[model samples]
Target chain A: MSRSLEPLLTSRYGIEESWKLANAERAGAYEVARQALTTRKPEELREEVKKANIRGRGGAGFPAGVKWGFLNRQDGEQIYLVINADESEPGTFKDRSIMDLDPHRLVEGAIISCFAIDAHVAYIYVRGELAFSVARLEQAIADARQAGYLGERPFGIDHAIEVYVHSGAGAYICGEETALLNSLEGRRGEPRLKPPFPAVKGAFGMPTIVNNVETIASVPDIVQMGGDAWSALGQLPGDGGVRIYGVSGHVKNPGLFEAPVGITMRELIDDYAGGMLGDRPLKAVIPGGSSTPVLDPRRKVDAPNEDHPLHKWHGQSEIDVPMGVDTYRALGTMLGTCCAIVMDDTVNMVEACRNLMRFYKHESCGQCTPCREGTGWLVDVLDNLCNGRGKPDDVDLLVNISNNMMGNTICAFADGTAMPMLGMVQKFREEFMDAAIHGLPDGVRHDDSVRSMVEGVA
Target chain B: MAFALTPEREQQVDDILTRYPERRAALLPVLWLCQRQNGWISPEVVEYVAERLELSTAIVKGVVTFYTMFFDEPVGENVVWVCRTLSCDLRGGKAIQDHLEKKLGCTAGHTSPDGKFTLLKAECLAACGQAPMVQINDYYYENLNVAQLDRIIDAHAAQGGEDAAAEFSTCATFGAPHGSRGGSVTSAPPPPSREAVRLASQPPPANDEKGEGS
Candidate 1:
């Protein structure tokens, strides 16, 4: 099927100074917000969103409409809408591009989302590392407010609407919805225990809805093109709309491409990314962000029989699998952030795992024991293996620790930390074992040079 | 020296305080202002922030130490962060680090003897499309090779170096349409000159004060 759909979220990207409010409005920016506020009731907009089936673009693929439906909306209680712009997930840069290039789109989407949920206030929690994105977003909000699209009685509506840009200090844990809440409340960026989810009790003890930048940015387009039409644009049934797939590392054209939901990985790398850099042989691909399990393009499934889900790809490599949430789940990985990190044959997998593990170790919020300790343990073991001091049992030990770390934390941070390690060590067990028995290949730097620079600042 | 926000910065802090419903919620932005006014977040600045927001020093210090961006101790005049993640690593990120260390007369985590530049490693600045990039203060210098690195370092080493480096736009151009294949490097202006490398390596006169805030 031809999955090349017209760009919705990224249409304003290439335009000169698209971040400016004047340029954005000329390209039809806040017309949805204006129309939604004037013509449609909040309930109608919410129902339409529910019908559209837009999933969160931030790692977790939860339905955005379902998430909004969980809001308590108790009388006399304040409701909040937080935009999770903390795009710290390694190999993910799509959200940054949106906030940087088309801030007005996000501003308009936030307005529409708030209007639907009856939330008068919204906060865009952006990562501090993205200073430029923050500046652009802040400017957009200012211009939006000045243009009478924000503040009390926005767009001639009777309700009050306010939007603020909040900057997060460097902490990957803050990307978690609850952790983001805690960070916004001026606490340590640590995840809180569940049962009282954000929809029930969120920021500052209010009913809050946290949506990803891309998820919220998709709202304007969804509202303009009716829910069913937007739903029809996807290659898969429920996976609606086009997703911005970021192709980085060892690609001829390492950039972001807005393609349909069910486009194949081979198409992304070949047609969009212009194939591998220097025509090198593809070794493996992190089909999502670094948190998701790595996928070896050459590995064929060894399913027991035809009844198994893996049977369909029993003898085929995962390179051609259609990219979607359900498809990746069946393949034992996730379509996380849809940002693929491609590795060529010349790259060392062990060192690469160590590099990613180090990031998880440094970013672990100490609230959960497994993530705080297990991430460190994983990094140390991987470091030993990479530096030739590994024991024979280290490979199995890595899997054991990864198994223990899974499903043992307040949030999925530990699981995220463990999944990639398990994926790398288990998928490439022979390579790790070879390195354990006989050190890393010559010319490989053994020094602890990969130590996080954030450590030095701390 | 005692920590205090300048009159203008104090006004900005007041404005920031109005954005959040609670006073403590403004702590992060307030801390950012204090860090910008002064070079890094010292104990005095932490105390000042706590007093300003009615938060305890313990809470303020806990926050300062938790984030990687807030420097507790003094950093160099210019903080250069080179991303060493897997994506950048596959595209010669290590060589960039090695070249930086040699050129700066310092290791990845240390500052130069003259306090001109501090070289540090970063995870990912979300500019992987232009791999092997570095962030000098608030601006990102991407698609860097040895020659490009030299030009950038030399430009920053000279007096009012940031002005000379102003040609490098902070805004990313990677958002261009997919068909155009607009890598960030394509948008970057050509190199200035190789003249400042010697000045950068020699470390002109020592200036204890940090570079101006972003």
Candidate 2:
């Protein structure tokens, strides 16, 4: 298949002067918002989004339209649409690019999303560390409001939409929807229990829809072109639109690429990314953000597609995965946040896990006892293996901790932290054991191994 | 000398307090202010923050301990926050840390013997493309290789560099505030002076129920 237009979704981002809300408005940024206000009913808009088949960009491939459909049409309580801008999922930085390059895109998308959902209040809960993006977004919102695109009586409509930008205080758990709501409500960033997912009872105890930056930003396309047209934008079956994926590590062009969903990994690396940098050979790829299970470049992903629900969910086994949303799911992982972290041959998988452990352990909110302790334990085992002090069954122990931590916590953050650990242990068990045998390679400094081991394993 | 929260600072603290519906929910910002004043969250400052925010000492401690941004232990005169996120990590952040450790005779999490510098490996500071960066005090030195970092450290340690060091002393001095959240330091009021604090302490307006009435 011939490649489509190269810029894709990033076409607007190139024009620096066009980044302003006014320019964007003039260029049809708020056209959808106006359309939602004047032309379509809120329920009709939601239905249209459902037809678009847009999926959540934050790791999970949940249908965006379906997620939005879950929001009850009753408008008694104030509805909220929170933009989860906490893009700290290790390899994920596409959201950052969106917010930084043309925040008005997000503002436009958000306004349209709010209109579609009948939410009068929208909050952009930016990660604590994203100062530039926050400023950019705040400015975009102010500009949008000045142009009557946001705020009370926006887009010449009877309904008013108020936009607020709130900052998270540096915690990864806040990336989780409910956890983000809790943080916005002035609490520590920890995930709230499900059964009352954000759709049911979210920010300030009102029904809310929490969406990733890209997911929300994708709304305008669906609103403008109609859902059917937008649904045909990507590569995956029933996928929608080009994704701005951040591909790093060993890639020649270690940066962001806006590509269709069904694009193959080889195309992403070899064609878009210019292949691996230097002479390093491809070893593995974390197709999504850190949350997805790592896939060995050599091994095929065997995901079976039987008619049974159990088989459909679990029997999905090894296949040569591509970069699309469906392909990622087929590989027992989701095209999460699209933070394609590529690992080359030179990288010691054991050391990489150690690096990842430090992140997981540091970012764990410590809300659940299992996640709080489990991440520490997994990190310790990985640390020992890296420091050449691994025990025989450390591999088994890592898996055990990871297995126990999955789906047992208040939020998916626990599972996010566990997935990488699973990837490390499952895909590179021998590397870890070998490191334990050989010890810290010559110059590798082993600091606090005893401390990390005692604390991590115990 | 132990610095106390000036009335203006206290008002700022109170404003943060009122933003939260729960009176005691403002512990993080209050402790942050206290740490800024006292150069660390000492036992006394934590107590003061706890009292001010209507939170217990342990509760305040828990918040401080949970966040890596809040330093529980005292750091040196200058804190070097190194970004260790994926982009920076790929861009040789580990190598830079090693070099800094060798040059400063301290690892990523330790302070120098002379109480001059404390190196802390931090999460993403959002300057990913410019990897191997360090926020020395308030100023960020980005795109730092070993050579660039050496020049930075050397510039600080050079003779008659105290003035320069003071000018470049904090991450806030970099013009743009660096964080995933604080909306940059531009939004933050400049560090309060002692006299400003004293003047802020005198209560005047009665409509202070809006949290931090000065």
| Winner by TM-score | 1
Every model: Cα RMSD to truth = 7.9, 12.2
Per-prediction TM-score: 0.91, 0.79
Q: Candidate 2: misplaced stretches above 4 Å?
A: A1-8, A17-19, A22-28, A73-75, A301-320, A440-458, B1-61, B72-79, B85-87, B102-106, B110-117, B124-143, B151-214
TM-score quality measure for candidate 2: 0.79
Q: Where does candidate 1 chain A have its weakest 10-residue lDDT segment?
A: A449-458
Candidate with top lDDT is 1
Give TM-scores of the second chain, every candidate.
Answer: 0.79, 0.68
lDDT for B171 in candidate 2 is: 27
Q: Write the per-residue lDDT of candidate 1 for residues A139-185, one digit (tens) a residue.
A: 99999999999999999888899999999988989999999999998
